[model samples]
Target: MKTDTVITKPLLEIDKSIDALVKQIELLSFVNPTNIEEEKARFFSSKYLTQPVFKYPDINFDRFKLHRKLFKQQIELIEDERIKNLYEDIIYTYSGLIKCIETIGSGKKFYYNSLHCFGTPTEIDVENAKYILHFEDEDLDSQAFAPKYNAKEAESFFRAYSEQYDFTYHIKHSDKISAIAMVSNNAKTLVLNTNHVYSDNEIAVLTNHEIGVHMVTTMNGLLHPLKIFSHGFPNNEETQEGLAVFAEYMSNNLTVTRLKELAYRVIAVNSLSKGYSFSKTFRLLHNQYDLEKEAAYYITVRAHRGGGFTKDYLYLTGLKKVYDYYHANKNLSLLLTGKVSLEYADDIESLIEKGLAVPAKHITDAYAENSNTNKTVDFILKNLK
Candidate 1:
């Protein structure tokens, strides 16, 4: 006697499967810091395990093909043009995610990952880029005061931050490198690989950049309603890194030297893509660019670490792009959430405005801010737009 609903059972099944797949993959973390040789060995040596493959409709290389696809699938589902447009604008971001994976697999190279982004178009640019690092004697002197990557410092920072935020976090340390931070739902962790090697200036920048900005955004995204918050949009690092550096600027910690350091990173990374060896790249930075040995070594190692790869250039390059975007009066809030880029900001904001940008179901602790967030936001708004 009752009329049937417009939605049928088959449609319901697809939704259920999507939900299940999302659940299965949501919390998985893949952390591979191995060099290119190791990654190559692992990739080829792995036995061909049975895997399900689905051929989505082939995406054309036409301009905005990704935008069209998102409109048909991801964007249309949202039911709000404002939010839909935001998603549409950022469809190309996935290219960065893909590029990151590709660069890791192939050698150093850059390319136009999206309509708004450009970099090395061939494999050779990785080795042709240049790099230089500059620091004063006082900066070197301050290096002795920097925190060591031992359990003591790790436990201290983790405990202090945990107490402030009321959530548990972990730490990872490596003697050979500086530091890296990894964030996921309900947890934050720092990897102090080169804690022994970084100067005080670098340490301050790293701590605030990684813990304050990266970790804070991860926890914030976790508080959103969608799981996508934690996964981050494509090419999210550009905005995130820029915001981190911006945060440094906001905190009165930004320096021209830091900016130059990132520029050098891009140059060094560009060189690695061209197959430059560590020593050769070192000379380029030292002799050609007139950088100190220590500085050149840092740049060289970044390129050499992943089998003569230069993906690290994106950090600096991404920061500059994001900064420019901010000044151009673009949406900058989404970046406050996670490793997303400025390119996706308008899209995310549109979604938020339309109520589609709901909070995630779970979140870690929020860091205690000694100052008002509005002050920083206002400062950024004035400088940016």
Candidate 2:
């Protein structure tokens, strides 16, 4: 063996640090099991109330204000874009934290509605050149997300979408959609758990917002030079969700009632986070907000049902930020370039023509051509002026 054999490993210490930082960033993507358990105990523990009460804690008042201060300091010290991106990530992360904390502490629920049968089709009986339509209802006896829908139809939907987008991978259809984006053994494909909790209006709003923007960005990012694009940009969910809700507004699908509903949800979820029972929150929205019991119940269930699911508050707050960006005429073409809403359909359409955000690769065909959708579209198109 040669005495002076050359070493192959890189000699850069900064590279090692960079690698370590990248690892830390990746770890931030998924929830930690220990932290999840601690959060669960904090919510479920009977001693939560008696232990201590936070009286307008500084942490509670401004979730990310401190984080922003810290970020500014870090940015001053760092020159690398990766490290800078980390600060941006932290800011977005803290925003969700603030909303969750506020939502949990609000002590109001029961305004959340668990509306059923949102995305599924309505049956029509035609007579004398007139079509009579009926919205379907969920069957309590069935454990399906929708009434009598099959995976075959789900396969068709995704397949058709794939063909339009000129790409195909794996897809799994499901009767149940676990909102948790975790390790699900059910199947490897994107699941469509379309039991109708949202309305036709809500469906259009979510479709553009969720599938159109969120899912579309997901797929388009996959086609990028970096595989991470598919994974989503850093701080993706906040941007994605905020953008999605904004799309609905751009398309003029976002209603005042929906906005107010999100506000109520923020209050409801915050109540649950602060240890209020479902009944108490339900009563709060019902009594204070003048929401009916059924409406209040849905809001409460969404907030309190899963015991500390304080994530719904982002809808309204996100909508506000997105709308503000739109009003300012920001580089929303980037916002529109993904599968997104026409929140400001006209503004978005301009970008689409320029090949920024692509047009929808898929529209729910079952409803797209229907009289109901046509009427809704017509109303929206007319009002756009």
Candidate 3:
């Protein structure tokens, strides 16, 4: 609406069609195993020797038909070459994701597909994880480390946090989520783990990480004329996860324990590339790394679920990139303008200029002030390879 050039009806129609198709393909909806609690109990009962068989949500949509429909779109009708290239990449990305979802629980087939979508952690990433693991954890006596709140209390906390923004989102409790908390973008819902307990600092972390950034972008994406903003750009996961974790850092809620957990994720993910099985990865984290059995099991589940999910490693890598970007005094708000990638900042600006996109409606509150006081955590982040 800001541009003088007339928007083409064909482009709008194509965009709308693509949006509708892509909305049905949210990877998180199917990526998480449906029987996590059952599998967890089984794995624990076996004393960490058994390889748990995880069951995933059924893919309701026809993948082949969806694929056909996606490619059927006449993207060539868009006059702008840059926009055309973006759409082309988006189609391929979504196509790859469909393959990932389709092959879930198919062992190495799913792992290879996952590798194609989200690459495995590199040698440097492993080193970074090892580096973080070398640091001593904070005092256990600290109130920030205590798990004193239940899922119901977390819902209340999230509800209160939601009051700060002019947006409405649902909060639901589930036992299926890998992480303790996550934001489902398409549904505009924040899903919390029903069985997990929350610490005060973790509540703050989730509020800013999930709602402040994830939900904020979810709403902001809906405001865009271009629905791709709402669905996501190609390889938007790293940037989105980076921004979410960075919000924790900015809010002063990021603890060394949390950073170590992310590091453990990198280690866990790296194990997959080495052909480690679920039990093997669990041993690597629990026996060699000295992580608690429950903690290690969950981390192992995150990596081994959906057959070698390497996406968890992105958090540390993304945090490093975003941290460097922030130190360089870059415009953080631009990156917050929906489920966007940092690499596409210029493209987003172009979209805004062409009246295809708009600026972020809600900025992350954590970005407003440098409230972080942990100099040790700062040193570790600054030194990450």
Cα deviation of 318, candidate 2, in Å: 1.5
Question: Which candidate comes out best when scored by TM-score?
Answer: 3
Off by over 4 Å in 1: 1-118, 121-151, 161-168, 175-187, 194-200, 273-275, 304-310, 321-332, 358-385
Residue 46, model 1: lDDT of 44
Q: Model 2, range 1-385, lDDT digits (tens) per residue? A: 1111122112123223322223222211221121322333453364322222212222223434533443343343334344345434444544343333433333232112111100111111011001111111222222322333344443454455445444344555332333312112111235454332433344445445544455555555433222222333333444556666666655656544544565576677566545676557767778876777656655665555323454465554445556566557655545434323333345345434533335444332222221222343233223321
Which pairs of residues clash in candidate 3, taking residues 3 or more apart in a chain or in different chains?
Answer: none
Evaluated against the true structure, the overall lDDT of model 3 is 0.89
Q: Order of all candidates by TM-score, from best down to worst? A: 3, 1, 2
For each candidate, what is the lDDT?
A: 0.47, 0.41, 0.89
Q: Where is model 3 more than 4 Å wrong at Cα?
A: 4-7
Tens digit per residue, CA lDDT, model 1, 182-215? 4343345666543344444555566566666777
All candidates' TM-scores? 0.60, 0.47, 0.97
lDDT of 2: 0.41
- Greater lDDT among 2 and 3 belongs to 3
